[model samples]
Target: MRRTKVDRRVKLHRELAEFIDMDLKMRGASVILCEIYGKWKGLREKEKDHEVVWPPMVIIMNTKLDKDDNDKWLGMGNPELLEYFNEYPAIGAHHSYGPQGHHGISVLIFESSTTGYFEAEGLG
Candidate 1:
């Protein structure tokens, strides 16, 4: 059977979710939610100097994460798993309080080229 875009997306989401879950579990954190969105290429145009462009991915979690935490999350991944993506995805975290007393954070895994904008906007 031929694999469709949706199939590929689902596979990617599952793989990433599992890796993140394990990483968080090792740190005593639990995953309340993990979502993977479609590929985003907006940063490619924003950064013209780089030859390789990474897609922007967003993950929602129940725990707060800082810059160091984000860095560790990326660093914890094994090379074999990391090679699946071909390039490193810049990870950033945003703390947010939802309605009805809900608390969690939104993590934006994007390209390093757009780090300045994300950090300046307090999204990273």
Candidate 2:
């Protein structure tokens, strides 16, 4: 067998929600990192920049994703995630906040077989 396995480390904004871990658990999604959006937060932490930097978003991915899968996702800017398993490995934005917090979240979905290349881009 090909033994297809595609995995990734998704970093989401902290101010997006109270508990993304709980949200993922509620939706039954595996979690790679369960900490707040610190890198960005840390930057302005000393300055106490309490501005909304990360929005509410969900990173629902089926681990064991393959390079081919990632290749597909790369093409599609952002497509629905739940339509086809191993096809479009993403589904929804789940929730979000203002521009500052809204932008930190970035995700893309693409499949080379059926939909060709579709997308919705975010960078939070």
Candidate 3:
């Protein structure tokens, strides 16, 4: 059977979720939610032609940890996670705190070579 783009994407999402789950477990944190999705990025060149790029595979992770804990964790940094990002064609990671500081969200962006429009998908 031939594998379609959707198949590949699903596999990628599963793998990413597993990897993140493991990492969070190792860090003694629990995942409240995990989302894997894509978005389109517009690029304008000096030439009159407009180009569209598939930005990156965004993995939004919501953890059970609070803002203070999340902040401390992020401040310490994750070398392993950094290494994983470095290994792939990725942008980077961003961490944000919830309004009430009850939970935190971490966004990991992995750059994709393909260019096209895609919808967001949630894994958790």
Q: What's the lDDT for residue 94 in model 1?
A: 39
Rank the models by lDDT, top first: 3, 1, 2
Candidate 1 residue spans exceeding 4 A from truth: 1-3, 34-124
Highest lDDT scorer: 3
Off by over 4 Å in 2: 1-18, 32-45, 53-124
C-alpha lDDT (0 to 100) for residue 44 of candidate 3: 29
| Index of the highest-TM-score prediction | 3
Tell me how far the alpha carbon of residue 90 in candidate 2 is from the true structure, in angstroms, after superposition: 12
lDDT of 2 by residue, 74-121 (tens): 211233334333343443433222432332233333322111111211
Report the lDDT of model 2 for residue 87.
41
TM-score of each: 0.27, 0.23, 0.30
Candidate 3, residues 1-124: lDDT per residue as tens digits? 3679889989997986676556556656553533222221233234645543334445445433423544543221334445644534345666664455423455555444221122212211
What lDDT is reached at residue 75 by model 3?
28
CA lDDT for candidate 3: 0.44
